[model samples]
Target: MGPYGVETLPPGVVDVPAAPAACRAALVERDRFEWRPADGGDPAALTEEFLLGHGLAVDDLTRPAGHDPAGPCGAALYVSAAAGAAMAGAPSGAANPVATLPEVAVVVYGHARPPRPPRRTEPGRWWVGPWRDSWTPGEHADAVQAVRAAIGRGDVYQVNVVGHAAADYTGDPRPALARLAGLPGARYGGTLHGAGWAIGCASPETLVEVTAGRVVTRPIKGTRPATDAGRRELLASAKERAEHIMIVDLERNDLARLARTGSVRVDELFAVRRWCDLWQAESTVSAQLADGIGLAALLRAVCPGGSVTGAPKRAALELIAAVEPVGRGAGMGALGWVGPGRLDLGLTIRTAAADGDRLHGWAGGGITWDSDPAAEVAEAAAKAAPVRALLAG
Candidate 1:
């Protein structure tokens, strides 16, 4: 109806096929680009150009993430946005608290796929120290109050408050990290090991997905312990519902910017879903992409996703910069696959990173006018618990 080439269909991961497992991925040379957001450039657009220039369209869906170096061409992709990397304008690309990776990195595998069947890695015994949080409860609560006051002043409707935690570790982190890759209901779950850093994501939220011409974003807002009672509580909580809908509206607008006029729609709203032992509220917003829309334009339109930032994105970023301590490291941005006209990137919420001798993780939630500071703190803990437990093991 709108454009692109994709047929009109319901959006979200429900409509997405299980991502082809990158069982054995070989990092062919990554043609690197150095675009830093701190210098007033767009991280998304840089990655887009890299993706397009590589003739990076994947057609061999049957092949695993990679095949024999000389095997018939097959394609797949994986990208990581370092912490809260934003689009053109507003402030972002804060120093990564632990990892030294670029603010945004979009990688496509080249030749030299596989010379032999990849051997399954047996991670070595590891020890993780007690994690030290970047902010204390009092500090976190104060930031929540700060956001609420900003809302009171009409600066913004809502702002997501995030905090970081890190601990020293020893030995191989790959095994424990592998757990993050298969998290229940994780649309984009996997571990990517780098030179001295590795990222493990168990995120259950979709930042954006484009199939054919339709673009969809699933912004998750509410969180509760997974229980029959929690389900009832999440469904009945006026505050949770309010947070959920605000993001749904924000996403609708995000898609509208790149979509054909009058093509935006909310395909699903406030759907209760499970991620680990927690209950999360999610909604799908979609639109038919405008004609001649390229990857660069798409990333510019939606870089720091709404669910992670807040409504009136620029204003929220300003407030967030002033209040939060430390950077997001490898969390709170995008991670997942990108293809010719299709991509499935997850908002890196429940994600953790291993940088050298330390393991890092981040967690938090949206703050609104009705938020309770203590409750918000506890909720962040609950969201972070699974990742911490996995690392502790």
Candidate 2:
């Protein structure tokens, strides 16, 4: 759901499933701001051209009375981590077989309309078969140690290593998505179904939000259970604080590109927010969009958000590609709406995708030089528990 209200597909809206050819065709035919493969040309130069070609602009703040705040609108877009990595000039490696979603999917709503409350439905039972993990606990520990070694050698500062889990299910996932949407603090929760696939996300991190002429991104990096003692520990942990600050700096730099000189600032730092049973440390970095900045330029500047991708993003991507065996399909991407004068997207953590009888979910954390390998594995399990339980019911 959007911050102001719930947004749903109106009647007659069609679902375009995850297929390379069909998805590409749908984007080409409907999307006003499509990302082409970045050639050797400068990314900044290409961004300028793309924005100009689309005539995209923020809502004029000085509009006359009675004018809507959200100006001319465009389609809703979902860009996976792989697509975002490609746009950022990084490789996403091989695709995950279990979660075979498109690299990007765009839903074009030809006109702008106010969001309404989502319809409520009765809960349905979903019995999931035994779950399997991509990596054993010991293997995940070794991967964490490898990332720490890279940090020691100055190959990278921090890399977010993730693991995948999947289970077979026997019922419609829409009911499960509905239950997830109702989860506490589920800000960017929704479900999208296509021909043979469906994706449901109840993400908490705000990757990027552009309103009027200001762009704000809240990057969450630290986590602990929501118990009083856990909150205290997270607030006082030097290691977690260091990890959170690094990503905050990275986000500030990303937003600085399109921001007016000296206009970028960290609005909030190391703030604790609750999501389900966990308390996450988040920081808000924002900036005033430079004159003539468009959606394409903004997205290009701050995509594949720093929270999911570690600091020194290119290095982190390299390490992630080297260590993780499976791809991070729908997880760790931007999932939300993009419209005229308004853009809101959440990091696709705590998200799952279903293809046929299989339900796929992923979870992981940042591996810092001081990270405990065993503890990291346990943390991933803690993060995956809520979603896993939701699916099991």
Candidate 3:
């Protein structure tokens, strides 16, 4: 609710009927607006009240903020399943599951109408795309240094490390996006092809979603190129299986933390999701939320995603902090929307963005005690391929 006590629509609900199936279509046909990621700042402080803005909205408007339980600041009117869980509920410092999740059904999801693309207003200067200067080229050494530091401090046994590079282009992003979306290994595909902000992603990974009070979280733990006929053989390697199992166990624990006693269970384990370029060992964990526990509260208990964060979440976050730059700028964030007591969301992986001066992209690999630093570095490079392609061309 706004300060004037106006009741806004819950997160993920667009006024258009086509929102559920084709959010971009509904948005393009309606009021044209330029939107970008907010700096997690005070909305009231912004002076330019353009006809529109773009950002996420979370599920369950009723869930109170951790620092202020009585107030309201639902951030976005729509939130992705991941952000919902990440931003929802109070900070759990390890306690009874109920204490951490005061309200169990909080669903995470959000919506963003496409925006007029960002361009250089100055005719002489061209926009090179969003710059992630915080992480620069030849930073593999930096990543390794950070990891070693974390290990030295006992912050984590292993933490996934990411690296970023830029992709610059001057033409319409759709063609580039279409090319990626049509790739051979893409199992999940979507494009928010706005005049300004274009996200063409083909991800075989499903972070989390909920419908009819049922919560589903699918974690893609392993990835290998599909062009290789021996992809299954590669996935069967002990290292890959161990990586997948650790994540599966982490996911199960995450769900079980919020699910009813004996209600949380694994729907599938070590399942394969075949995509255009990659074959993945994905796992599905699900559970029934307690009665009267709205979606907003549910998300608060989990977020930034367990798959990305690794097990022993808080420790993992600290480990990530030691390795990463301060501003993620939507890199590991979640996107999509929530509304009408149901939601659909996807991880913000395989994404590219233009923020002011530079174009940027990122990719990384999960790390375990068994991980090889060189192999992990290669994985990060492999993931960056599409992002670089989008802008390089």
Summed backbone clashes in each candidate are: 2, 0, 47
TM-score to native of every candidate shown: 0.86, 0.82, 0.66
List the candidates ranked by lDDT, beginning with the highest.
2, 1, 3
- Which sequence of candidate numbers ranks them by TM-score, best first? 1, 2, 3
Q: Hey, what RMSD does candidate 1 come out at?
A: 8.3
Estimate, for each residue in 295-366, the C-alpha lDDT of model 3 and write its tens digit: 435444556676766656667765665566533433454444444444555665675543222344557777
- Name the weakest run of 10 consecutive residues (lDDT summed) in model 1: 1-10
User: Candidate 3: misplaced stretches above 4 Å?
Assistant: 1-19, 22-138, 141-154, 172-180, 184-188, 191-200, 227-230, 390-393
Preferred candidate (TM-score higher): 1 or 3 = 1
Instruction: Write down the lDDT that model 3 would get.
Output: 0.48
Q: Candidate 2 — which residues are off by over 4 angstroms?
A: 1-74, 98-100, 110-125
Q: How big is the RMSD of model 3?
A: 10.7
TM-score, predicted candidate 3 vs. hidden true structure = 0.66
Residue clash pairs of candidate 1: 6-212, 181-190
- Over the stretch 1-393, how does candidate 2's per-residue lDDT look in tens digits? 111111332332222221122122222123333332332443334433543344333323111222222432344567777767776788775566544355665544333243333344455556789889978999999999999999999988888988888887876665565456556777777666544566788888889887767888998889999999999999999999999999999998998988889999998999999999999998889998777666556666676778877979988887888888888887898777654555688888998888777888889999899999989999999988888888676
